[model samples]
Target: MPLILFNKPFQVLCQFTPQEGRESLADYLSIPGIYPAGRLDADSEGLMLLTDDGKLQHKIAHPDHKEAKTYLVQVDGAIDAAALARLQAPLDLGDFVTKPSKAVRIAEPDWLWPRNPPIRERADKPTSWVAITLEEGKNRQVRRMTAAVGFPTLRLVRSSIGPFSLATHPLMPGDFIEVPANAIHK
Candidate 1:
């Protein structure tokens, strides 16, 4: 089965399921016989994996596989080293304790396109960028985690997944690329 890497744009659904007046994978991907390995929320943007092979899907998306996912996040407030350290440490998220993750401050990218609806900008309020990596996928994990650390996310983008990096592929919004099976693990 062929593996596909998609750079899902903001407000685009990750699955083929039709949403009420919202964009979905059906609008962007035309490849037949392949389905998402995992998902990115409609409000989020970045890397997503798709495959026709159930086993490969399981290997990539299943929690047991512990594949690390990296994200570049813009938060609503200035981020400090202490807050970053808290993210790296386990958190008690009520239902379960999150796994160890990595967080570090980064400079905002100059090439990011303006968000469609636009993120609210406050001249008096400050924002910061951070790159975070997690081995576990959870519902809005990045958003929730950053919020828990007192820096609510303003924008989020997945920069890498396991062995694949968006840096090399360089997908603009709504673009996708096919990866041969042999290229996936290398």
Candidate 2:
């Protein structure tokens, strides 16, 4: 089975499972047999891989594969180089330390679509943006990392995973495109 790259929209559930009043992938995707290789929280949005192939699913989701996932994070506080450096360093998250990851400050793009139920803004406080990449898919890792550095994440978006990128795809919120099975291996 081939793989599909989906730009998951905010508030949309990552799976076909019914969420009572909440929206799900079944609302946007009609392709049969394909299941999400991994999940993105409904509060976050961006690139997600789906496929009918079990091996490919394991390859993408299994920690042993070490596939890189990158994210663009909007944080509550102004991020500095020192803060970014701490994000890059292994974070002692109590249970276990996070793996080393890349983090950098970046300017916000005007092209970004307005998120539904827009993030809260404070007159006295400002926010900044950063890009971070990790090979491990720990639950809420990016959010945890940012908070650990004293900048809580306000908005988060997965920008890329392995060879697939949201930048190259014409996906708007809730849109998806299928790629050849071979593309998954590349």
lDDT to native, each model? 0.88, 0.89
Model 2, span 42-75: residue lDDT tens: 8999999999999989999999996799999999
lDDT of 2: 0.89
Model 1: how far is 139 from its true place, Å?
A: 0.6
lDDT of 1 by residue, 32-145 (tens): 889998889988998998999888888888888857899999999999989999999998777878999999999986656567788899999999999999999899999999
Clashes of 1: 0
Candidate 1 off by > 4 Å: none
Clash-forming residue pairs, model 1: none
Clashing pairs in 2: none
Worst 10 residues of 1 by lDDT: 108-117
